[model samples]
Target: MPRGFWKGLLKVLAFFAVIGGIAIAVLRVWFVDVVTVRHNGMAPTMILGDRVLVWRDARLERDDIALCRHPQDDPARWVIGRVAVMPGGEIAAERGQLRLGRDRVTHDVRGQVRFTDGETRHTFTMSWGTEEFDDYEEHLFFDRADRPFALRAMTRINGLYLLGDNRAHLGEDSRTFGPVQASGCRGEVFMRLTAAEGGLPDEIPHGALDILD
Candidate 1:
């Protein structure tokens, strides 16, 4: 091979190596998972045709956005919602809802909440509350009327419950399925890259902050 041609080829190889390294680093930082917006399930919070990134192994905090997978024996699917409740915590949904734990409290849809010490209260939106609780219970096998689906506690270390603010009116969610396991969670969402037009109010600032473990 010509001396000049050999040098040029080496430079090309070096450039590709650098590009490959960058790609790997990006993937490691931002765990990529493709989630399909099934229905108006998380509407007003998340819309259809929206693809998101979940920062795997990111520092989790109150009100952090997340992309979660469905529970076992069900469809292999994904849903996007905020971290309503995390591990070692108890979150109640409806008044008569039945959860494993006993501590129950009444909370208005848009009411301000107080968290445990060292925790901050994030202004979360109830994009949609249960529209037809009666309808849902009438057909539920466990007699939802007497026992509302309650994910009262998280026994596991990384348990998380994600719910659509648009409650009953929406489709599948913890209300329908149950609390999502930590293993099912894909990652945390730090930024909404393309579909930034319609999203939750400015209650929580919107930006891409470096995800810390």
Candidate 2:
């Protein structure tokens, strides 16, 4: 090949590289980002190890799945949940059904075991107000001592009330740690990059991709 041919090829490669770098910078700054689910709290909706795309400026609404900084854990760590209650809304859990104002949102489960944190397993029959497991039941129930089935006032304010899709997962949402501040939300999960049949990679088939609803 001639010297001119080599020079032209090098210039083209450099130009494409520059464009790719700019595109990555824009995505990191203002567009979208990818995050891996770290827990099974949002199971059925989002399993553990699922890769999801989060839109930074997406408008949040009730029932939207989102990623937020844990209210009681390290600020840098993230937790994913559904927006059960938005700002300017009153939220409480009566029995196991979630009540936003007068409307009650009940999960669809008929005595199914949703999750197990340890030796203790949680079922849909056990309401959020009831203490089923002798160990850690007090921590899982959100109601205050005075109000048996109602959430504390700390969770009803200028923030969002998030709940795990898997209602049986204890100590995994506003029910345990309180509501997350609006500012603490990282972004709303709008897409799923990769999917698996189970929470682990071993359970995923050779080629399976599922889009989140």
lDDT by residue (tens digit), candidate 1, 1-213: 899999999999999999988985788556654443445444444444445555775655545666677774455677666555567655554555433334442222332222111112222323222222311211101111222344444444246766653343334565555666767667776544445333344442323332311
Positional deviation of 137 in candidate 1, in angstroms?
31
lDDT (Cα) of model 2: 0.62
Give stretches of model 1 more than 4 Å off. Answer: 1-25, 28-30, 34-36, 73-75, 93-158, 196-213
- Judging by lDDT against the true structure, name the best candidate: 2
The 10-residue segment with the lowest total lDDT in model 2:
133-142
Which sections of candidate 2 miss by over 4 Å? 1-29, 106-156, 197-209
lDDT of 2 by residue, 1-213 (tens): 999999999999999999989986898788888898777676656666678888885777777777889988888888888777777778766774456676664332222222333223322223222222111111122221222344554334568888775565656678788778878887888777777445222222212245443
Backbone clashes counted, model 1: 6
* Count of clashes, each model: 6, 0
lDDT of each: 0.47, 0.62
Candidate 1, poorest ten consecutive residues by summed lDDT: 135-144
**Candidate 2, residue 183: how far the Cα is off, in Å:** 1.4
Candidate 1 residue 167 Cα shift, in angstroms, is 2.3
